[model samples]
Target chain A: MDSEYKKEDFLLLFGSRIDIIRRKKGYSYERIAQGCNIDGSDISKISKGRVNITLSSILELSKGLDIHPKELFDFEIEA
Target chain B: MDSEYKKEDFLLLFGSRIDIIRRKKGYSYERIAQGCNIDGSDISKISKGRVNITLSSILELSKGLDIHPKELFDFEIEA
Candidate 1:
């Protein structure tokens, strides 16, 4: 599209948001992994924007963090 | 996890939300398709919760809808 942001940028921002939330909650990747199928190492990769996480992953992450999935996407994106 | 809702439910809810937004905007799937890689048919599948869309697809859908990606996930998910 004509937008300035690319898919990669969006993924990076999403990952950063996850990192921020987990850190704020004092939850390690292992802690988050306890509630989901993803490995703690995979969570780390996802937090680093290394994974193209799916909708299922989103649910897993939210369940892991015990928060609404929408919270993960609660970050700014210029219109 | 022990939550009542499953990943499938989340996908269904998310798809419903997209349908709500697109309809509210008076946008057809074809119209949304014009701005992203997803086809109108795929959008139809997604709206029906038949597709487990990826993060990139989320970005494409947001671009297609001309809204923040977060808006796509703006739905209530019970704890």
Candidate 2:
């Protein structure tokens, strides 16, 4: 449950999840950037949990990955 | 793919998804507010697609709903 985690924790986890997914698809930050409005540097920062990105950014990331937006939230929240 | 939609569209969809989930759980705005930092009125605005909420807010909403954050994003994007 999300109750067990702080907001930053979830952001960090979501970032890593994005990292994993992008890597799995063999996408470079530039590659992802080419597909969306986000810059490659921003994507790097996001993957490191440095960005408190909004829902629109999430949608852009999903577009960059060519995946469903829900997939970005697919990582597990450990207890 | 998220490429089919704009940022506002995703926000609206995400908002509606939250509305659906809260209704399914029989959680009113006040009920959810009691579980998180968000005010009931803000939740209403968020549900109406009027807020471009950050990652932290999403976490709080998930906590309020006692659900995984991914569940908040489980709706389909129609073409």
Candidate 3:
């Protein structure tokens, strides 16, 4: 369904924000993964836009990074 | 650059939100495109996760939809 496409898009966006916040917080992939209970390799892949992550993982990452989940999408790229 | 991947992820997430809001508002792709001054085909591609859009386009789409730009990233997909 078309909705599936939309879901994928959302995941990609959310994943990117997670990567930005991680770097901004000065946390490495392993640190974030250990803190968030997610796989470090998956974090690396997600940061590189090679993997899609779940909403639960996003929440965990948010908690780990001390950022509001919404802040991830707050800044926009110029394109 | 890694930043490029993050940017792409943001665009994808923003685009997905546009698609969800458009459907919720009962608007067609063409209608949103016409109102937002973006190419309809681009809207279609963006919605389908095939195209990356600029932040300006996201703002225009938000204006056309009467939805807060932040709302697009408000809801998280289950993954």
Candidate 4:
């Protein structure tokens, strides 16, 4: 993560969005990661905003989650 | 952008992906920005990976582009 990028900024925001989408789709991180051929720990990290994902991973996760990657940013969190 | 995120890495990668998607859908940045209600400059920055966008903007752009956000990351660029 960039020192300029507060963990609270992108991570929490990204995590919350991922959480909402995952719940809406009824998918576990493990299941989604498996389908996307990525590690479950990585997915967990992503959902928690601990990792910054590549565009490719984002696409794979979307496919696994059955959501538009844009939905990952649908919710707003106050800074 | 994160110092950890090399401009050449994410920017080029994201840019190429966006370029591919935009071309595939025949969308100009102006049209997408207008549809998404974001600044055209901002959209240009994003396509070039010069700025790190919020999840909300990502969602909006996806809607405007008529693409699953995941498709934005479908292309791979060599680091």
TM-score of each: 0.94, 0.95, 0.45, 0.49
- What candidate 3 keeps of the native contacts, as a fraction, is 0.09
Over A1-79, each residue of candidate 2 has an lDDT whose tens digit, in order, gives 6465887888898899999999999999999999999999999999999899998898889889998878888988875
lDDT per residue (tens digit) for residues B10-55 in model 1:
8898899999999999999999999888999999999989899999
**lDDT tens readout by residue for model 4, B1-79:** 1212333565567666777787888888887776665677777887786756544555566656766555555554332
- Single out the weakest 10-residue window by summed lDDT for candidate 3 chain A: A1-10
**What is candidate 1's CA lDDT for residue A7?**
80
Chain B TM-score against the true chain B, each candidate? 0.93, 0.93, 0.69, 0.74
Candidate 1 stretches greater than 4 Å from native = A1-4, B1-4
Q: Against the true two-chain complex, what DockQ does each candidate achieve? A: 0.63, 0.78, 0.08, 0.08
Q: At residue A63, what lDDT does model 2 achieve? A: 86
lDDT of 3 at A2: 19
TM value for model 4: 0.49
Output the worst ten-in-a-row residue range by lDDT, candidate 3 chain B. Answer: B1-10
Candidate No. with top TM-score: 2
Model 2 residue pairs with clashes = none
Q: Model 1 over residues A1-79: C-alpha lDDT tens digits?
A: 3465788888898999999999999999999998888899999999999899999999899888888888899988876
What's candidate 4's DockQ score?
A: 0.08
Docking quality band of candidate 4, CAPRI definitions: incorrect
Quality class of the docking in candidate 1, CAPRI style: medium
- Please give the TM-score for the first chain of candidate 3: 0.66
Q: Which segments of candidate 4 are over 4 A away from where they belong?
A: A1-7, A77-79, B1-79
